[model samples]
Target: MKLLVVFALTLAYASASVLHGFNSLEDDTNVGIIHGHNAAPGQFPYQVQLISPEGLQCGGSLISHRWILTAASCTEHFDNVTVHLGSIRRSAPRVTYIVSKKDIIIHEDFNRYTVSADISLIRIPYVKYSIHIKAVKLPKIKRSYPSYDGCNANITGWGRTSFDSTHEPEILQYAKVGIISIKDCKKKFGKLGKYIWPSLICASIVSAETWEGDTGIPLVELRSSVQIGISSVDSPKPELEYPAIFTRVTSYLKWIKRHTKLPL
Candidate 1:
């Protein structure tokens, strides 16, 4: 099945990095553009947790006052979830938090294979809470698509230090890289003969690598920082000295608006 293929490929990409044991992004310099304070500096900004029937501690992005975007795979089914806010260092106890919430929205046509539409938004039913967190802006919806050569793009993840190597990082980790042409990346990966969708963006560094646990991470653009691309899947070819793939946020604004419900 297409769904199974997508899920399997993604699992491979996330598992290649050892530090995370299972969930990891295969490269080290997972890229992004910070809209707020630097994440590594502490980032209680939105204390993110991934909870599923198996366990908790998935991955998420601190995007807005009441929303944290993350992998739809990690949120499809949940018992209880929480989001922590407004601390540079999540290790501190003075952070803000919201518990006993559910996944408020998810992309409909989300294909787990290409990792397209992997984005999801979680909302705290109640407003007043802990940390000084504000909503990170969403990208403007467009009937048009732009190339990476002219757009700002990057990805972020709080995954482990190494691929399947050790414990997950104590603090969130982020990196910055630009989006490249999917045609170039697939061609380099020797898969151009295959399928690279219009929704996917390719990225790489001439001299570095990305790792696991970084899947579902945000690949951001500098112009607005709000114009984001999400890293939903990765390819594992020897050609990828440094390779990355992301889901373009601007392309999905319509889906986001449809799913998000504001207070009455």
Candidate 2:
């Protein structure tokens, strides 16, 4: 029996208006850093910031020189999409890349209501590799990485630090989280468990305040460079600190290979 409470979760969409607010650290002071810490420069080079005229909307990963992996929900509507690369701080120094809507590809099986097949890809022109920007390793198709309890993992994004706060961090932030087995994850939501698609993976977060703008943040396995999941959904009440939902990348290995020319 899923609870009837839904917190006002904000997507990590960073619009030009909100961009100004993120730049103000003073505002962030009171908001409290509920979870996650500042990410080191180039620590997660494959990480990319997805931006629309709306501002910073979602997070994405560079799978190849010309391809980015993100959530289909982020590109639902054809809009001008810009990507920022090689920067830990969104408010300052970095290389930026932009692509057109025609280049965005959402999986054909994508279901908006269920958020199934939530994955999407952005095809950009070939970009030269740099220390701050590189493609992330996808898990081996024949081999599956551990997703058991206490499996090491980390997630990075510029979303709000606290569940109730509207302030997004000016710098990139990352947090270590544990993987929750699907069965255990399902039990957390009771009735809501029915909505949990098998294609999605779940992770345990100390603070579940996932905002709308964090739609496509990458959930990378810490030990190896493998990116295992993409931020997909969260519990209705983020303040309650529920497990975070992600689109399991391993399940779509074939689909990703078919779409992008990654050396998968």
Candidate 3:
């Protein structure tokens, strides 16, 4: 199974490339949620759609009025991004912001090949909080990584609903997933299990699966509504039943605080 890191971006020279080991899917048929449903207006206020200059898309979460947390792979190769927020429909957002490369901060140790240290932060012009636009709570900073095994979580994005389709939904899509231990997740990946590290978290596919463009979306605990992960990479083959991996948010709390300078 090919592990797709998701998102396609065009370089400054106008050459297109997928993140990490990703390859573009051929089909262009429009698809909706995968074993999920359309999110209601303001249901996922923290959710944001990140669009590169060349039109490639990825997902991100608003952690503060001026800060968006996303996958490093989404912004590592590029500096500028168009962020859409406060709307369920991608076409008509309540607010839009353009962030320059100077405000985009990727992890210093980010590795595109191994997809390690896959988290990033993008700062936008400060905006007032509203019902349709709000920050998601993050896990508390601690010396040790927090575990949420078997906990219910939700992921939202406009990514392709299936592996074969390249189409992304116009409306925001969300799915309920269950968190699993890294040990169990490693067993599912088999030979690829070595890449499963403590800094990352895994979630069972359940009836739904994440596809390209879902990268950088938040994985929020259902009980407390606290974000715990950022969408990282996953196998495109659903038949393998590989658990989706995400950059554990708890593991980077200090990094975030240092960069964003926000009090937890």
lDDT (Cα, tens digit) per residue for candidate 3, span 216-238: 88899999999999988645344
lDDT tens digits, residue span 1-264, model 2: 012233212222322211101111222342222366777888888878887766646888988888899888777665768888878877663667678878989899875456478788998877778888899888866666555456768777777665446566778877677788888877876766766667888776543224446778788888886899988764454334457778899889889988875567
> What TM-score does structure 2 among the candidates reach?
0.83
- The clash numbers for all candidates, in the given order, read 47, 17, 0
Q: What is the lDDT of candidate 3?
A: 0.78
Best-to-worst TM-score order = 3, 2, 1
What TM-score does each of the candidates earn? 0.71, 0.83, 0.87
Among the numbered candidates, top TM-score falls to 3
Q: Is candidate 1 or candidate 2 better by TM-score?
A: 2
Can you write out model 1's per-residue Cα lDDT over 56-109, one digit (the tens) per residue?
445556565556676665555555554544443334434435444345566776
What TM-score should be assigned to candidate 3? 0.87
Q: Estimate every model's Cα lDDT from 0 to 1.
A: 0.50, 0.69, 0.78
Better of 1 and 3 by TM-score: 3
Q: At residue 223, what lDDT does model 1 achieve?
A: 73
Q: Score residue 29 of candidate 1 by CA lDDT.
A: 37
Q: In model 1, where do residues sit more than 4 Å from their true spots?
A: 1-56, 88-90, 93-102, 126-132, 150-154, 205-210, 237-242, 261-264
